[model samples]
Target chain A: MTATLSRIELMRGLVGMLRDEAVVAGIGNTNFDLYAAGHRSQNFYMLGSMGLAFPIALGVALAQPRRRVIGIEGDGSLLMNLGCLATIAMVAPANLTLVVMDNGVYEITGGQPTASAQRCDFVEVARATGIAHSAWAQDTSDFVRLVQAALERTGPSLIGARIERGPAIAQPPRDPAQIRDRFMQAMGSRKGFGA
Target chain B: MPSDSAWAGVVLAALRKHDVRLAVYVPDKVLIPLIDGVHADPFFTAFTATREEEGVGICAGAWMGGLRSILMMQTSGFGNVPNALASLAVAYQIPVVMLVSERGSLGEVNVGQVWSSRVVAPVCDALGIPHQTIERLEDLAFVVDRSIVQAHATQTPVVLVLSPLLTGGKVFAA
Candidate 1:
């Protein structure tokens, strides 16, 4: 697997294209990079649960059909719930986008090899799983163009960005309740918790 | 009194009363009517989850997006959900109402269903999720309605089991 993209650079590129799209980042290096790029109340860092970013985003997109939602997951986490890909394809929410940060390793827990370390190309897997619009980001500029197109489109899209693991800038706030509350408020789904 | 199968209708009525619209499920024989009902009803955004944890995540996200949601699965499937329930639903205080078609208990024929059935209650208790078993038709409406309504009010996940006594149980080979 040849890689040249940086995780943070890709994060900046992805986030830079968003206005109010809700981002659900999986519990991995993706979580840290999302917060590091720019913390938005709209960004819900799923900092503890692995493999849920896509499912959660699917739910959000289903509930709010007009609002776009994006989910970022690592190769390890996406591998954990590969079945979710089929589920997302079943509902096929037009407002959902998923970016699998395929570093081929669990870069968080000391860089252990993931099942996707070799012989697993998730873009092909996702395309086979019927995500309709799936592609690989050949470079950072291509990543931006793909994501920007995902935002403007009306189909569920999956972007597989092959990247090299680099220094994680920072971790999202470890407070789960605070993360949920802020994200929900930003979506206008709730008002002033506990009042 | 509602008959064994009519319990699905009873629960569906409660869902409508409470306005719970997002329905994610993987079904068994006992859940056929309810699952079918959800699919037929235009009010629900119903779909089959390929796996239980995926359903849990969807319900939580739907809740966050201001829709009441339910994840329906068999006891066997519940075995796949403790981590998701604990880490995402519980930790984030997202109320994901869970509907379980509990197998492997009284009148159960399959040996495989027993272990998962026996563990569901303990698992919910361990996760600090409120769980209730509906054994009779009389208890059906109240439990289903209150569980859904109160889960949202408290922002907690819940497990509602459909007992064989109420559904007549899935029998072996006709």
Candidate 2:
């Protein structure tokens, strides 16, 4: 049933599943397509930065121990902050999920090849860093299955989903900004921002 | 009343008092005295990092491993490391105390340090991280103690910006 869906479609499906199950309380990223498509899920889009989504998700997960936090990351973005995986592993937050959409290029920056192409395999690096579960997805069906499996497991999980490079999607600015505000509001209540 | 040496003694005491057992630092001309003091203390385990951001990442990992940790670097190093602070430390809510020696301010000489140092506070503020600036040696003990307290309370990174006067005079006694 899932064979016909594209990577984008599968990602939408996974976001829907996570939201419907109430498993994920928040999602965050820098990509507009991911942010716009994730409106229903209320995902946070980090507009100004390149590689902060994973660490923000980590903080959220740690603060709300009862809730799940997912970071929708790009390969280029993840490469910029790869050391975060080791930090995540050391903390071993059970509710954190890092999903890296690997198109092997920095789409936002004019389709340049990222350092990941030559340096290392992100999933294997995650495993080596002590994250409990790490794996890659070749297509939509595999992505759905991997995400579902990761959601059920404990400890930090890194899912590298290989995606086809394409033109950037035209998205409304409102969706991304709204989600960012909502997530910040949620984080602000956690103990420190104003208190 | 504690003199400069006494203040330094209190700064050391607060570190131990807060159970900050792990420290990562990148050498800074201004931080030489404090670094030397930290090295002399057996209660603290200190490692030197190649870059400021590497120290931030290592301290984040150390914190996650049940060790309380801090990072010591210069203001110039801080300018080179927004990626580490915004992505790894802020994102993960890792309670890392960054002891930054402020440069290029009053009596400044380096042009590059002056430019980036000006943006430090605004950048930290925009990221929603907390920071305190200390210019007097007398304020060191209070600032360091509050930093440790706030870091643990929020489980987030905190910065203590030390001016040249507070960190110690730029030129060491010959």
For this target, which candidate reaches the highest lDDT against the unseen true structure? Answer: 1
Q: Give the C-alpha miss distance for residue B45 in model 1, angstroms.
A: 1.2
Q: Write the per-residue lDDT of candidate 1 for residues B87-151, one digit (tens) a residue.
A: 99999999989889979987787888888788898899898999999889989999999898889
lDDT of 2 by residue, B19-80 (tens): 88766687877676678778898888765665566566456534543457768887878886
lDDT, each prediction: 0.88, 0.66
What TM-score would each prediction reach against the true structure? 0.97, 0.62
CAPRI rating of model 1: high
Q: At residue B109, give the lDDT of candidate 1.
A: 79
| Residue A136 displacement (Å), model 2 | 0.7
Who wins the DockQ comparison?
Answer: 1
Q: What DockQ do the predictions score, one after another?
A: 0.85, 0.13
Candidate 1 lDDT tens digits, A99-149: 999987888788888888778888888988898799989899999999999
lDDT of 2 by residue, A1-195 (tens): 112224457567676676522122212223555544565433555543456566556545654556666777778877777777877787687877888777677776678897766666888889888886888876776777888787777888888876667764544354433443344444443222453
- Candidate 2 segments exceeding 4 Å error: A1-5, A20-30, A170-179, A186-195, B1-73, B82-99, B102-133, B140-159, B164-174
